[model samples]
Target: MDKLISEFDRALRTVFAPAASVRPHPDAQIDEPAMDIADKRHAAGLMRVNHCGEVCAQALYQGQALTARDPAAREALRSAAHEEVEHLAWTERRLQELGSHKSVLNPLWYAGSLAIGVTAGLVGDRWNLGFLAETERQVSAHLDAHLSKLPQADEKSRAIVRQMHADETAHAETAVALGAAPLPLPVRLAMRSMSKVMTGLSYRL
Candidate 1:
């Protein structure tokens, strides 16, 4: 019951509350570039997508941790979730700086991702880790795309994305080291399709 309550509280905080980061903001030292209105709006849209992605990540990790059978696996998921919270904070700050709001569909994104995470966890540890590893790999690729799309002068967003990319790569490697089995091609394709839908809607809505 206590764990359930904690998870509920975490969900509320993740979706509604301002996120706090332990690490310094990735763009703390970079000067805010003077972007024109169009660039600012474009940057905000990309950051909004990134922010929604982090929200999904938090839910996915929590769900995986909730059902992970192995103690080590649970701990790993929890640790990754913790770092994702920091990502949330960084992206939230960047959004504010760009004068943009987070996606209105964040709650929907979180709920759907939580369900997927739980399903992955129930499939057994090897597959659970595989799901996580694949998630991180896809996220890294998404971030790379964002890096290319962001305005040339918008170094703040780029810095955050770069750090996030590095962290996600490391997470994927960790999962592989922990005995993650490679997911079949069909499953991988399905994941990518869902990601495309999320990113496409999140960019505007």
Candidate 2:
């Protein structure tokens, strides 16, 4: 019952509470370049996708934390979730700046990611960490793709993406250092496939 309540509280916070950041936004005080309609639309779409990704991150970390048996592992997961709140806050602000709304299907994304995280946690600590490592690695690479695709003059978005990429790299490294095992090739492939589907949908929806 306690766990159920905790999860309910987390869900409420994630979906409704205003997100606050511990660290200043990467784009804080940065002057934005004048963007044409095409560039602005493209940037907004990408940032919206990024925001959706952060929402999924919150679900994944919180789900894993709830199920993690090891105290240290649970702490690590929760800490990661806290850090991800900053990402969520930043992306939310960026999306507003770009005059775009979040993905309409965020609830679905959160639910699916939470399920995945809980499944991974049930597999044991090593596999749980492996899943996180793989997730952060994939996200880092995804940020790279966004950086390349962003308009050259969009320095604010670029700064935010670059910082996010760095943070994700650190998260993956921390997971590896904590003894994350390599996932099976098939699992990795499946994760990639799912990510592709999510990104495709989030881009437009």
Candidate number with greatest lDDT: 1
Clashes within 3 Å, all models in order: 0, 0
| Clashing residue pairs for model 1 | none
Please write out the lDDT profile of model 1 over residues 60-160, one tens digit for every residue. 99999888999888888998999999999999999999999999999999999999999999999999999999999999999999999999999999999
Best by TM-score: 1
lDDT of 2 by residue, 5-122 (tens): 9888887788667688989999998997899989988999899889889999999998788788888788778878888889889988988898888888888999999998899899
lDDT of 2 at 92: 86
**RMSD to truth, every model:** 0.6, 1.0
Q: What is the lDDT of residue 121 in candidate 2?
A: 93
In candidate 2 the C-alpha lDDT for residue 42 amounts to: 94
| Model 2, runs deviating above 4 Å | none
| Global lDDT scores for all candidate models | 0.95, 0.89
